[model samples]
Target: MPEDVEDPMDYIRLHLLEKLQVLLTTAALLAVVYFGLGRWFRPADPLGPIALLPGGELGKLLGIVVVLLVLAAVAAAATTRSRPEGALMTALFGLGGVAMLSPPMQTLFWSYPASMQSLYLQMMAEVLIFAVGIMLAEGLGGLVRSFMAKICPRWLWTNTLSELSDQQRKTLKKSRIDPMWDKNILNGDSLSVSSGVRNTLLWNLLSLSLHGKNRTAAQKQVFRGQLHRGFGCLFSGVLAGIVLLVLLLQSPERGQILFALFGSFVLAALFAHHLFPVRTFFVAWMIPMLTAVLFYALAAISGTGNRPQYQVLPIDWLTGGAGGAILGFWLSGRWREIRIFEALAQAPPE
Candidate 1:
């Protein structure tokens, strides 16, 4: 009866359309991640004969990855959508441009491709990674915050909260911290540790403080942008990276001896952020770590004598995992930070 109310058929139609949009977007993104990573790491099977670094295509694969990410960033600039959507849209177009330049996907569309058993199994494991990471980021982040507050020294929190710059104060306002409770964390209830929610606030404030304290003015500006971007936004980029990796392994051109060396990044949002950074990086390392373990376990379970002639050895995985995870986490975080700054910079100055 009112202008605000919609007809039932109209609602059904719109809901269907929305579902269709999600379906198309998911497929497109799945294509982009799968094809992009496949083409990049063509030379190294990680599970097959090609191998990874030290003896394989790790360096070359990595070099190409940096180039493609830059390409992705450039492509993202062309998208009018918001941050995460822009990133995905960029990947879609970036994959197209890549395919045009190199139609190497022919061999992959082989009529009789290698057995997908290993890859499928790997995919299952990856699904686990995403399930754990995506589902837990909110809960685990809060939990870890509480855990940190419960264990961390009161002095550290007091010191961090005590010297809140105007920007820091604004950040709290932006985060919607309760004024009264914020005051408690800052100056009240000195002896009693804050409850979980309050402790969560303390941990985030502490994160902001720790990350921004020694930064240069420009860097601090970026850090403030990161604070505004918030951990969830930063984690979205991390989510995109892991999603890319998960899709990477599902390519039609596959062998059991597989490695998504290109997409290896902080699998961290799965467990936890920046200490936080380290924890996040550790999770990123899980991409490769899980890949390595899953394959080895699969091999053992199958009792296959066709052991992989790994060019990328365990050491390569460990070091690559460490570097890639940390770097990926930092880069994704930085991208979100810069993007937030770009948006904020356009607003009328305070």
Candidate 2:
């Protein structure tokens, strides 16, 4: 007789139901944003341009419904931990958000008589775009890294144990060591560890916890190698910001420019901070804000002659940038710590 034989199907069913609930909740939230809130805040003019898209208002409504459905599906797929599923979701959400703000949609909505009201609509649209962009960057980061690993030069790719043979990988798995730790192993010609203590924080933390005494030289070397791959998040944020700015520039209003600049900065900052695994909230939070400020200053200097003057109050930056920085820092810390706990749990007992 099989001892302690639990039915795996029960666990599978439980997980399936949990996932379904999450999907349903996400779909409901999206529906509220698209239908309830959207209608409540819609412009006073019933026959606005957005209302006149092919098939009229009903068509636009249906389009939103379709998009929401797609988003819900993507959200569910993202739970699977599958790279292709995540990549597809990322592309679909990111591109769909951008498409929603295309020229035709803008032309339709911008015709509202109340400028402030129209600006509100634009702002909401931009928020959706930013949200999707962050999701895409996060979801696609690993996929992009894996793809690069395959094509990158031998010297570059060999630094990580991701190139380990099947037997070696299996051995590591049996020992309860996460494959992700392989990212920190240096197999290249150089003997020294990668620069920057922050780069190997997670590896070091894990190594010290798992093997307090008699740590091997190879283990120490692995801890020194850089592991976190964050370029995808940065690239996605920048690309999405550019697309949003281009759309906003269609209207040369000062409000539009200010909103676009602030929104883009927050979006980029959030993604970058989230991707970085630093424990110091202050460092992670400030990096993105500082980067954004530098970029803003550069833009200001370059366009000094041609750009229209807008009085940018200090409070604006403090409120927007600080708020986003704090949120991103908190979220990243929470998520990173959760993964650490999971890894710790999997470690072999002393």
The per-prediction tally of clashing pairs is 12, 0
User: In model 2, what are the clashing residue pairs, if there are any?
Assistant: none
Off by over 4 Å in 2: 1-266, 273-276, 305-315, 336-350
Query: 64-131, model 2: which lDDT tens digit per residue?
Result: 44444355344433333221222222322232222222222234324433443333333333333333
- Runs in model 1 deviating more than 4 A are 1-259, 264-280, 305-312, 343-350
In TM-score terms, candidate 2 sits at: 0.29
TM-score of each: 0.29, 0.29
**Model 1, 125: alpha-carbon shift in Å?**
19
lDDT of each candidate versus the true structure: 0.36, 0.36
Q: Could you tell me the lDDT of residue 5 within candidate 1?
A: 17
The global Cα lDDT (0 to 1) of model 2 is 0.36
Q: Model 1, 152: alpha-carbon shift in Å?
A: 28
